[model samples]
Target: MRRPLSLFLSAVALMMTATALAAPHPVPLSELFPNSGHARSAIIINKVLERYHYRKVKLDNAFARQVLAKYLAALDPNRAFFLARDVERFENGARRLEENLRRGELDAAFDIFRVYRMRVDERVAGALKLLDGQFDFGRAESYAFPPSSASSPSTARWAQDSAELDELWRKRVKNDFLTLRLAGKADPEIRERLQKRYEGLARRIHQFNGDDVFQTFMNAYTETLEPHTSYMSPSTSENFDISMKLSLEGIGAVLRGDNEYTVVQSTVPGGPARESGQIHAGDQIVGVAQGLDGALEDVVGWRLEDVVDKIRGPKGSVVRLQLLSKSSGSTAQTREVSLVRNEIKLEDQAAKTFVVDPLANAPGLKIGVIEIPAFYRDFAAEGAGNQDFRSTTRDVRKLVEQLVAQGVDGILIDLRANGGGSLAEATSLAGLFIDTGPVVQVKDNFGKVEVETDTDPGVAYNGPLAVLVDRDSASASEIFAAAIQDYGRGLIIGEPTFGKGTVQTLIDLNRYVPGEHNDLGRLRLTMAEFFRISGGSTQLRGVEPDIRFPGADYLTNHGERSLDNALPWTQIKPADYKRVGQVSVDRLAQQSAERIAQDVGFRMLTERSKLMRDAEAQTQVSLRETERREEDKRRERAFKELQNRFLQARGITPVDEDADQIDEDALDAQRKAIARIEVDEAARILADRILMERERQPRAVMKD
Candidate 1:
């Protein structure tokens, strides 16, 4: 039912992997009130969470208070709109929230939203007025707006009065103008763009309907339980269903709201965005446009769904994006990327193999690399009993045999940006490297445990093996990585995984109340959790690498651990399994550490990681035009030097920043310089691992 593996791997190689408001015409908005069905929906959601959510939370005063806190944070993550007094006014309502929820009363939620709407209207008005006046960029001052999330609200002080809030808006408007100015826009263009952007922000706020309010408040309630657990309004539910049922015809990137920005979580293989080799996870999408000639829509503070609609369009359509690269940190300059929308194909995500030719320094030690974007399976074909059914294990099994035939010394499964897929494939894939044994343990809310084991006894390829993972690796990815690490069958490398161990199932709220319309929406509830064979849960503490890369520590405030109320790391009884004890991690780690210390690319990566962290930590930025310009230029110059150093080492000429055109191969060379630092290093480590294993083997002596 799917394409053949040979065809999918024909070119097997190394892997690397918002809407705008239409018119200036403002829509008349009325005070949003909860719909008639919202009350019943809220009550039903409360019941579902209480009975089935993996992290069982009581609906008492403490939880009620937490939900209120989460709600406020969700609405005003930047502390730009709501005042301190507005937040205090809701404290008493917070105490009564849970009781009201059980009684199907949502007035408290609606009340807070009304106040938020009012504050937004006021703030945007102030920002618009500030745009009329000239800003003295020569004067030295700094604008501060540290990023915030639902789990962590802004730690900065909230304005006490209207006058203080107006001043905050003044700085905000100035920052916007300066940002545009720095991007090389003229003063008039900056003003017009800022005006439209601010107007769009105000227009979107007024367009909020009852459904949006209900869904937002409900998510605030559910997200406090777990980040994955959420409530979708009917309209959102429809979009979710469409995306799940068919190939999404748009930029195939998963996005989430981080503070006021829409941050890309991961890119789907075969999608335009992924294939373009531009957009990436953690990149903040600031602006989106329909075509080459269309006006760019500033989507900074727009709703996630509205922004999504602007990006998604018919196949063959061109969508342009202004992205703030995740690796570039918060203060970096934005880059424009153009992508043609297309359907994300199934074959694009299929496992493919690449034979890394042994480096000159390490000849006769070829390491085969298998880049799996996702743990995918053709469920329809499998259910229909198709013998040639496509699956991760089947594809990987074929690739492993091919690699062995190529006489590679070792193999590395690259799961760097893989967000995981089929669960069964994770189990079957583990069986390829290890003898029959338990792969992973699953536990339900009732504490009943189910163990999925490898039934086959024959090994596919059992030589030196390692798994490469990053913070984006999750779910089934963690399962396979954990199994390999537990059985001592392979080495785990890269940063810690995404740490999302819980499973979620969607429940239709319409089914709960018979005769009710399907407009009741749905609740995605976490029902089960995953645990390693060695008794540890991969919930918040994802599988740790045996030999971690340099930048792993700096990314601690990411993945599942960053979510509020994420289930803590727990353990169950160890499953029955024997260890192979094939790896000598200590010696390999020491060798890898030494190489990392001297590697120029690794050194650059470490600095960039630290720079990103430092940028995130900074609460202020200079508004003085010359000072800010110089500061940004210095950062850019330093990065260029790091890149040039790598080029110079490789005997290639360094590229000038002011070059009118860059050779495609040179661009590839530059990418190779930075991206392959880890990939090529991982190969060297595997090469060392292969030698270590050989040394452990008994010497064959001639008996004359």
Candidate 2:
């Protein structure tokens, strides 16, 4: 059962809330993808496009031509593959593909795929050759391999000697070449030898292609969408599940393939592996097994996707792993760890709070700040009567009421890094602050519109407010900020946000009959775009800060609006809301600006951010690996300098030697500490401001 409002409020009040501030159109079903072949291609391409914030295209001939050009350019920007003479010819080939598929010309489409595949292979080969030329294999050190589902802890892997390992690699390379020659059907003896080599090469290539293709393709797909809807080929989906849920029974470590072996990326903090502190990043996983009695399979030559599947299993299950220590070479050690799987709520990536008093301007004013990371909802739990489940709306409502009871003079809602989540939660969450008014406007493909409003006439708290946002704050973050700002409830602070103003509805084409050959795919079409109550589309142009703050946003290629094919920013009619007494923003802006000038830590960070931007501008590959490494070192040095300055400003002593460079454990501890400090600071600042205002009007009395 849901807890009483008062009970919820009590548990939440102590949390700080320095405010950070943080869409889509619909498409016709018929005109989208005409045939099965076109449908499949559209699904793949749309997924890529949507990921990159391109939702305007409807998979028509015009859309196909434009995207194909971009896709081809991404693969070969110089147009060197087909040559300048054949550039138009290759595009003509791609453009006619959809039309040919519509006429049941599968062979023609296959031809296109064959050409595309060849070009892709060539690009991969080029990148690999470049990689080989850049780095010295002699300088490459060996690492511990994590246990796989197929391999056992007892399995002696990675060859006992370096000479043996070199021999193994030679055979592996030889087999790959043999398989490439034997791909076509001709001779039985040659085919048989080719098949053997082919299987090994295919698996290895699968591992490599899995990382590059999936990452690149999904990135491209999402870039076309509104930055949310994405295509996660089963394995990527599993990784996401593990990352979001923060639990996996298999060895409690994340793995990715490097060269040939599956390398341990990192151990999940608080997991059995992390707790044991035995397994670490840079280790390699050569084999894995289920329980002590399970058979050990050599996974060195297996696909990483297949390896991952074998490793992940039910809770309370024991999995044995063969790991090679990074510090040791071929003569490596192994460790077996049994882990129980449970829902691992990611604390660091959740809604957290800190306090800020702005004491220089507002003394003795208790201001609670809540930084909502995302619009998370436990749908299943909520349905099961678990009303206290993790959520943005419920949690924030409770925190607000609690802060009010504690006599906080103001609140700051920080939605800085919130990427966004459920739309229902966004709307409901907005209602917590405002009494009743239209929150946002949603426009469909048919030009139909829906206006969402906060029907509840009760607000949790009414006080001085500020919403702090940055380029990373997007989607639902924009919705909430737009509502708050429109209502004139608080000051919108920070840089312009990530303007992801498009919506996607995942329509399964499989729902139709099979004979239609509509392709068993999902159409992530733009459904509606979000419009702010104050008559502006948070589409391409994000919400502008009322009192701007200096940050890294202005210095680099950032924000959703700074993307390709982004929907144009527009305006809507204003909503009904009584304007509150305006805080002298001009005065506040001047004071904040002057204060930031004196902040040595912030100044150093800005300078470092500019240097990083300059480095980022040069996307060209360095001639030598050593030169690239030197460039990396320069960036690292700058980061360290800024980090040291920040630590010193916060009265923190530097611990470079003992502490891990990034210091995950220490970072969490620091966040907790900072939260306390910021909350105290916010409260003190508000209190001081109130006192100052009272002194100026010394003849006033308590009216209420």
Best by lDDT: 1
lDDT of 2 by residue, 402-431 (tens): 777777777878776566667777888888
lDDT of 1 by residue, 442-511 (tens): 9987778999999999899878898999888888999999999988888899999989888777789999
Off by over 4 Å in 2: 1-62, 73-88, 94-98, 101-109, 119-342, 346-354, 357-362, 385-390, 514-519, 552-555, 581-583, 621-630, 657-698, 701-704
C-alpha root-mean-square deviation, candidate 2: 13.8
* lDDT score at residue 417, model 2, on the 0-100 scale: 52
lDDT of 2 at 139: 36
Model 1 clash pairs?
Answer: 19-307
Q: Give candidate 2's error at residue 55 in angstroms.
A: 6.7
How does residue 252 of candidate 2 score in lDDT?
Answer: 49
TM-score against truth, every candidate: 0.93, 0.63
Q: Pairing residues by index, what is the TM-score of model 1?
A: 0.93
Regions more than 4 Å wrong, model 1: 1-31, 651-662
**Worst 10-residue lDDT window, candidate 1:** 8-17
